[model samples]
Target: MAHCKTSLAAFIFSSSTDQWLAAPSKDLSGLALDKHDLEEMSVAQHYIPKRHYAYGCFYWDWVQFGIKKLLLLDTTNMEFSTADLPPGEWSKQGIAIVEAGEGRLGMFGFHSETSSDLSYTVARNKGESPSQWQMEKTMSLDSGYKYCIRDATQRYFLFTRVEASTSLENRLVVGYFSMDIKTLQLQRVYEKQYYSQYQSYTYINFPPSLLSSRRI
Candidate 1:
């Protein structure tokens, strides 16, 4: 397993050696990133807590001081790199990285508070051409309620709907739902009329066999 810090230093734990080893710095020249943008790079902050893993790499949504990009750590080579977000207005909204199956990376973006469509895009790389993002699917959501993406994993995303209000503190969470990335199925996980001071929520899905089996 590898861990990264703000300084871009990576440390890996080797089970065979039973020790933590520091990974060497990686060159970003081959990544095709602008020199100026590389200088301003920053890792994900506390507000963005979710980390995505796919294609032998771990990804984190990084945005700091107007610099927005995906910080990638390739576990196979123990190197760190960055990938630009998908183009368009959706990139400015709340987005989460997801595995799109078959060694592809997918992203889910909320289409503002008024829009009912949630945009899903996947990265496409063909031949020697640069990788680009292409729209895959747009899942329609209830426009009546305001939704906020809380967390995302391999194939499931956790989101909450809160009562629309001018003040953030006065807003009340009314519904919580988890959406399956593959099936595009929305499952209501929790619903209640309550005020929550917590800023984050985590959704855990257990396999059906485990849920039905008797506890020892």
Candidate 2:
């Protein structure tokens, strides 16, 4: 873990860790994926949401939860909630999310390896699932850098990195998908002109636009 001059901290681990931690900063704006020892940091409230179950019912049981309250100085009127998964509540083997259509909260999760298991969920507010969590119409990458999903101007983007075999290869995968915001239908918008295997691609987004595409 290293903290920059801006006090923004970044944690990098082994190769395996790099594969999973390729997600960008914006996706982590109001949320944290809580693990046992280490977790993502929030520049705002130092808020951390963990997966915990009380009694038979689960409370705050989310693999990753969004930050509902962002009180700068005063932590009063604190609102807390959890984003629920789909109706069947399929455990997200791999998950990613971004802001939905500007203000709504939208997320996509990969269930095992089956395209039929791929699902999407949107929330009006924090921690609240829409009436239904729908399965994506398309399939996700089978392997490589885990797919990170984001929305831009009513279109969804999927990012991943393809690694080259030798030392001379550049480390970036040049592929992106554009999708409809409502139905989760996707079409390939950007693709690699030349086949150069990349180590990994990191995804980050601005409120309304994609900020950077980095190969690290």
Candidate 3:
């Protein structure tokens, strides 16, 4: 899967095996959003394995792109659609997608302020109907200054936190935490602290097939 930025073109490569193909590019004339809107912002897409679908977030912010809306792909029907995010003040850093309880896809967004609870918009079931999307749950991540959810499940969730600092430093007082993925209650069970420095950070969870299969 790749995005064509030169033109209003995006692509999906379908093959039985992990074979390469030279797919011809074409403008996204009518798919997803309008052509004019597509030209305005680049799409940052992520594949949700549990749902067998993917979504694209429009790039609007520099440090954290695509904070406003998202474009969704229905793999079962091979159709493109747009969906509105949950109502709340969201940060690019705190915004993420996780597998909520019952293997439902959940849109995780946090409040701008640290004192508030993290918002979660989950789909009612494993279907494409937008009406099924509802406010599933919310939880707190106030253990540290700032936090981001990396992955989640019905039993547990993984996240990282960056502590407050006085001066501009290249390093971050980082902490890794995992807690019971309960409804409105996160019972902490694992945690660790360390200092990490990187040019950029990307949170991703690879498929088990790719992780354990023969290395490419």
The lDDT values for all models are: 0.65, 0.38, 0.49
Best-fitting candidate, scored by lDDT: 1
- For model 3, residues 103-179, the per-residue Cα lDDT tens digits are 56566566563544667688777543334568766665565466655554434555566664523364464655555
Per-candidate TM equals: 0.74, 0.36, 0.59
Clashes of 1: 0
Model 3 misplacement above 4 A: 6-18, 21-40, 43-63, 99-104, 113-116, 124-126, 129-133, 152-156, 166-168, 179-196, 199-216
Worst 10 residues of 3 by lDDT: 54-63
Each candidate: RMSD to true structure? 4.7, 13.1, 6.6
**Collision pairs in model 1:** none
Q: Which stretches of candidate 1 lie over 4 Å from their true place?
A: 1-6, 13-18, 25-49, 63-68, 91-93, 126-130, 201-216
TM-score of 1: 0.74
Pick by TM-score: which candidate is best? 1
Model 1 residue 155 lDDT score: 67
Q: CA lDDT of 9 in candidate 2? A: 27
Least well predicted 10-residue stretch by lDDT in candidate 2: 69-78
